[model samples]
Target: MSEAEAVIRNQSGYINHTAKKDYGPLEFTGRIAGGLRLDLRRRLPLYASDWTDAFKAENFQKSLSSILYLFIAALAPAITFGSRFLDGTNGQFGVLEMIMSTAVSGVIFSTFAGQPLSILGATGPFLAYTLVVYDMAVGADVEFMPFYFWVCMWCSLFTILVAVFDLCALMKHVTMFSEDIFAGLISLIFIIDGVRPIIENFSENKMSLTSAMFEALLFMYTFGLATYLSHFRRTPWLLRPIRNLMANFAVTISLVTASALAAIYSSDTNLRMLSVDADFSPNLVLSDGSKRPWVVNPMGIERSFPAWAIAYAILPAIGFAVLGYLDQNLTSVIVNRFVRGALTLPVCAVLGLPLSVASTVPSITHVISLTTYEVKQLPEGERKVPSKVVEQRATNFLIHVLIGCALFLAPALKFLPRAVLQGVFFYMGIASLTGNNLFDRLFLWLIWDPAKYPQYHYIQKLPIRRVHLYTLVQVVCLGILYGLKAIKETSVVFPFFMASLAIIRKAMRFLFTQEELELLDSLPAEEEDGKGLSPEQPDLVNLEKSKENDEGEPAKATMGV
Candidate 1:
C-alpha cells in the first residue's frame, strides 16, 4: 500500500478525533445533512476562536500584510472588470454599483458565511452574462436596470433555495479535471482580455504602432518582473522574512512598477488610465443625472411582466446561481484543499457572489481565506518545509470594505493607470494557469528531462496515455465554453456551460477506472497530512524509517512497492 493509504488505515482513531474536533458537519466525510442543524450557539465559538487566534499579537503583522495583498489583488481588478457592464446611456449598473454590492456582500458573507477563507469577488463569467443581459434588454426595448434587477432577484432567490435545500451536495462528483478546466478558462480570459486591448489599438492606429509595441513590451516586462520577484526566494543575501514579504506583495509591486514606467515613458501615448470621476456619489444616479435606485424593484419597470419573460428569466437565474456556486466553491477547493463539501447558497455575478457554501466553521481555526496561486517547498535544514500563512479573511475583507470607501476618491482611482491594472490581471491569470496541475500535466511531456519533471500522484499512478487523454477531454470542454463565450448572444449561457461540466464529469467515470479517478480527484498527500498535524510536528513515519535504516535493520515498508 502507498504511504498515504497506510497512514489512513493506521490513523483511523486520530482521524475520528480530528474530524469531531476540527471539521464541520459537511466537511470531509461528516454528514452533510447535519450541517443544516448548525446554529449560532455551535458556530459562534468557532468564529470567536478563529477571530481571537487571527488577532493575536504575533499574527498582527501577517494580518496587516494580508489586507494589503488582498486589497490590491481583488479591488482594482474588480473595478476595472466591473466597469465593462456599465452603460451610462442606457442606465445600466456602473462601477460604483459593483463596488457597493461587492462590499456589502463581503461584509454580510464574512459574518454569516460557511467558508470564511473563500474570497468573493466579481468573476468574468458573471460579467459576461451581465453584459449579455444588457444586450438582451436593449434588443427587447426594455429598461436595462429594471430587467437586470428582476434577473438578479430571481438569481439570488434561486441561489438561496439551492443553499437551503443542499443541492450543492451533488457537486461531489465534480473531479479536479472539471475544476481545473473552469479555473484555467477564467485565467485565460484575464490574460487575453489584458492583451487584446493593446493588440486591437495597435491594429487601429498604424502611425502609433511603434509606441503601442513599446507600451505592450513595457507591460509584459513589468508583469514578468513582478511575477519573477514574487517567487524570487533565491537571493542569498536577503533575509527569509524579507523574501517572504516580497513574494507576498509581488502583484502590488508589479502594478506600481509598471504604472511608474508607463507614466515616465508612455504618458503621452494612447495608453488608457483608470477613468474614475473626480466627483463621486454613493447614491444611485447615472452620469446624466438619471435616478437609479440602490434597491431594484422588479415591478417598477415600464413594460408589463409577461409570463414568458418570467419563465425565460428563471432559466438564466438558475444558470447564474449554478455558475456562482461553482466558481465560489471551486476557488474554495483550490484554496482550502477541501474536495468533499457542499455549497449551500446561490450566487449572483452582478451583485457579486458570496464565497463558498460549505460553512468552514471548524477549519476556520487554522487560517482564513489567504491562499497563494503557488505552493513552493522551501528548504529548512535537512527537509523541505511547506509554508503556512493565514488568510485573515475577516480582516482582509473588512479592508476591502474600507477600500470600497475609496470609490468616492475619483482622483485617486483615476491615478491608478489602466495598464497597471491590466498587468495585475495578467499576473493573476498567468499565476493561476501555472499553478494548475492539469495545465502542468498537459505540457509535462514537452520537458526535455523526464527525471526533472514533476511526479504528482496522478502522474505516478496513472498511465501516461491516460493523463494525456484526461487533459484532451478538459481542453475540449474548455474550447466549448470559450466558443459559447465568443458569441455575444450565447454568452449569457456561459453559466449553463459550466453546469454542464458536472454532467461531463459524471460521464467520464465510464471511461476511467475508479482508482484513477480517485487519484485525480484526491487532494495532494502533503496537504492531507499537513491538516492533521500541528506545524511543529515532524513527519514521524519518515523519521522512523530513517532511524531503522541507520541501525542496519531491514527496511520497513515504504511508499514504493
Candidate 2:
C-alpha cells in the first residue's frame, strides 16, 4: 500500500464523515470527474504532524515524473490568457509563441526543487491577473507592452531570488486560521468564475437552461468517454488505439472530429464543428507561413521599459512577486496534503519566467486546463507519492523535458477538441473546493468528541444547507466565467463579488457563532514517587496491567487519546 493509502486506513473518521453529502442532480459530474474519491483527509497533513514517515531527501524523481502533468496544467492558463495578449487582428503566432514560452518554463522548473504530482502551470489565478494587466495595456498612453514584459522580467528575477532564498519555508508559517481564509478565497474564485456566464447567457443568448444543460452534458459525456477510453487497457482492439490517438490531442481534436462527423450526419444540435466563437475569424492555416504577431505599439513604444525607467515599477513588480509566491506555496501545500516529499521553489523560479511567456500564448492554457482537470480529480491513493525530495525532482525534471519536446514539435501535437480545455477549467474549480477541507473538518472535529465530521452526524455546526448552497452558487459562477467569457464581460465583478462575499460571510460567522470553541487542554500531572518517577510510560492503554504496576489501564480513548 502507498503511504497515502495507509493514511486513509488510519483516518476513517475523516472520510466516513463526508460520505453522506447529497450529490444532487449534478452528482454524476463529480464521480465522472473523480470527485467522490477526492480525499478530504489531505487537508490535515497541511500541518506538521501526519508525517512520521516524511523525510525530504530524495523526491527529485517524482518531481521529474510530475513534469508531464505540470506541462499540461501550465497549458491551461497559458492558452486562456495568452490568446488575449497575442494580436487581436489577424494574429496566429501568439499560439506558437505561448507554447514555446511555456515549454521553456517547464524546463526550468524540471531542473530544480520540483514536486512530481503537484502539476504547476499557468493557473486560473494568474490568468485572472493577466486579464487585469492586459486591460491596463489597452488604450494606455504608456508603452504597456514593454511595461508588461519588464514587470514579468522583474517578477521572474524576484521569484528566482525568493526560491533560492528558500522562502517557501514561509508557507509553514501560514496558520490554519489564515489557511481557511485563503482556501475559501480560492474556492470562491472557482465558483464565481463558473456561474456568472450561465446566469447571463439565460438572457443574453436566450440559451435555455436545457440547452445549456445539454451543452454541459455533452461536454461531460465526451470528456468522460475520452477519460474512460484513455484509461482502457482491456482489449488492444480499435478502442485502445482510437482512444489513445483522440485523447492525446484532447478535447480539441475530439470536438473537431465530432464537428466533421456531425456535418456528415447533419445531426440536430451539431456536436462538432470547428468550435470557434462568433468574434473569432480564422486566417492562415498551420501549413501557411505566418508572420510573428505581437501585441505592441510601433510608434516609439520602446522608450519606457527599455530605459532605466522600468525600475520605477519595482513596487508593482513586488506585488506580482507576492502573488506568484502565494499561489505557488498554497498549491504546493495542498498537494502535500496527500503527496509527501520536499519541494523547493528554486526550480519553480527557473520555470516561472518561461511559464509566464507560455501563459502569454493561447493554446498552452487550453492543453493544460483539459489535462489537469482529468488528473487532479483522481483519488488520493491513486495520486500519492513518497516523502522524499530529490527523488521526486529527478523524475519530474526529465518528464518535463520530454513533454516540452512534444510541445515544440507542432506536427506531433494537434489532436483534440479544444472544448475540453474549458472542461479542465471546470474541473479545477471543483478541485479548489475539495483540496482544502481542513478548516471545515477541523471545526467539525472540535464539535464532535472522537467520532467524525457532521456530514456523518444528524446535525452540523454550520448548516448543511449553507455548504450546499455555496457549492451551487460557485457552480453558477464557474458557468458564467467559462460560458460567457466573463473575463471580457463580467470577470472582475464576478471574482471580486465571490471573494468579497466570502469575507463578509466569514466575518458574520465569526461574530454570530454561539458555540464555544474547544481548546486541547492537558490532564493534570499525577504525583509519582517521592523523587518523581518521571511519568514512567503511563502503562500501555490496551495492554494488560504490568506485573509491577498492578492495575489495568484505562480505556484507549480516555487514556492517551
Candidate 3:
C-alpha cells in the first residue's frame, strides 16, 4: 500500500489540471500579428455556429432559467457597486449608470463577442480606480467629467492596443494558483459586502432586537433556501424533472418567496427595502446639483482647466487599461478555456457608464447555471462531473434585455427588501467558493487524521504539507490584495497589485518540483469515459477493498471516490 501510494504521488501530476499553452514572448510585431491571425482563424469559423446554436428548441428552457438566475446575480452587484460609485464620485455616477452600462455592454457582448457566457459588469477594482481618479480631479480643482473623459479615452485606446497586439496571450502565465487567489478575493468581497449591513444594523442600535432578528432571519432564509434548492437536483426526494426545475430556478424562487414574505410583513418587520431612483434618468449631478443629460459632454469643463491635462490622462489610463485587460481576459480565459476578445471599456467611457469588465463571481455563477452535469455512481456515492456547457448567446442576450427592461420597473422593484438582496449576495459569495481548488486545499487543514482525507487528484498526487504550503502562499497574496483594497491611497494601484499575482505565482517554481506545481497550480482536467476514471476512483476502490480484507467484512466507506 505504501509503495502504491508513493507511485501515485510521484506520477499523478497532469491528472488534475488542464495543460496551459506556453505562448513564449511576443518580442516583435511579426509574432503579434501571427498571434492575432491565429486567434481570428480559430474564432471566425465559430461565429455563425454560435448564433445558430443559440435559438434551438431545447436551449429555450435552460436559457430562460439562466436569464432569471443571472438577472438577480448580475443586478445585486450592479446596484451595490453603483451605490459605491455614487458615494465615491459624489453622484456623478450611480445605479442608473451601472444598470445602463450592464444592460448595454451585456447585450452587445452576447450578440457580438466570440464568447457570450462571460458576463460583464462593474467590478470593485474599477470602482476603486474611479474613486481614486475622482479624488485626483478634486485635488486639482478641475471638472471631474472632462478629466474622466480623457482618462476613459486613453484607457479605451490602450485596451484597443492590447487587443490589436494580442497582448491577452500573456494570460498563459496566469496559472490556477493566481486565478484561485483572485477568485477568492472577489468571493470574499461579496461575502463582506453581504455581511456589512448586518454589522451596521446591529452596531448602530437603531432597530429593536426583535426587528433586527426578524430582518436577519429574512436574510438567512433567502440565502439558506436558495442554497438548498440549488442542490435539489442531487437529492432523492423528488422526480428528476421537478428537481431540475427547482435547481434551475432556485435563486428566483428563493428571492420571490422571501420578498413576498417581507412585503406581507413589512409593517410588522419594518425591514429596509431596496432604494431606487424615482425615474429612469441620468444619475450624473451637475455643478448646481441638477442632473446632467444622459450623455457626458467631453468638452464641458472649468475655464482654467489646461489642455495639457488631456495628455496627462494617459498616466492613470495605463493602470485602468492594465486592470481592464486583466479583468476581462482572466475571466474570459476561465470561461472559454481559451482567451477571447474584449474592447467594451472604450464604449463605457463614451457613454459615461461604469467600465464594464468581466465580473468573476457573476461570470462563474452564469457559467455554472448553464452547465450540464452527469452523476455517476462511484465506490462511495454518486458524484457529478461536468458533461457539457450550454454555450449559447440567447440566454445572455435576454438577461441584459431584462436588465434594460428593469429600468422602467422601478416602482415594482422598490418593494423588494435589501435583506433579500443581501442574502443573494451572501449566497453568491458562498456559492462561488464551492468548487474552487484553493478552498479545497485550505479545507484540508482541518483534517487532523490523514485517513480521513478525500482522495482528490491533488491529495493523491502531492504531500499534504506541500499542498498546505501552496495554499498559504495564495492566502498571503490574497491578504496583500485585500490590504491594497483597504487603503484608499493604495487603491489607485489596485489593478497593478492584481497584475502582480502572476509574478508571485511564477516565484513558486523555485520551491516546488515541476510535477508538483502542475497538480497544485493547474486548472482541473475534464473527465472522459475512456480515460479510465479519474485519478481518485481506483485508489478509493483499492482502499475500500483493503479495509474490507483487514476487518473481514464489507467496507462501508467511500472517500471522495
Top-TM-score candidate index: 3
Off by over 4 Å in 3: 1-34, 45-49, 56-90, 127-144, 204-214, 237-239, 268-271, 287-289, 301-315, 331-343, 360-395, 523-561
Q: Please give each candidate's TM-score.
A: 0.74, 0.48, 0.77
Residue-wise C-alpha lDDT for candidate 2, range 1-561, written one tens digit per residue: 246544654566554534665222112322322222332233333323222212333323223323444444345444433343342312322344444455545454433222332333454555555555445445344454455555565665676555444455555443333444444544455445534443454467645556555455544654455334323322356654353333333433333444344344344442322222221222222234442123333222334344543664454456566656555555442222111112222222222222331111122222221221111123222221112222223333443455456444443223222233334434334433432433334344345443444442213344544444433443443454344334554433443343343344345345334231111111112211112112122211111111121121111110000
Candidate 3 clashing pairs, residues 3+ apart or interchain? none
> Which residue window of length 10 is worst by lDDT in model 2?
552-561
Task: Kindly give the stretch of ten consecutive residues in candidate 1 with the minimal lDDT sum.
Answer: 552-561
lDDT of each: 0.54, 0.37, 0.66
Could you tell me which 10 consecutive residues in candidate 3 have the lowest summed lDDT?
Answer: 552-561
In model 1, residue pairs whose N, Cα or C atoms come closer than 3 Å (at least 3 residues apart or on different chains), thus clashing, are 114-359, 114-360, 117-369, 159-346, 163-344, 370-391
RMSD of each: 9.4, 17.4, 9.9
Rank all candidate structures by their lDDT, best first, as comma-separated numbers.
Answer: 3, 1, 2
For model 2, the stretches where C-alpha displacement exceeds 4 angstroms are 1-95, 114-118, 160-170, 184-290, 293-312, 331-392, 408-418, 438-561
Q: What's model 3's TM-score?
A: 0.77
Per-candidate total of colliding backbone pairs: 6, 73, 0
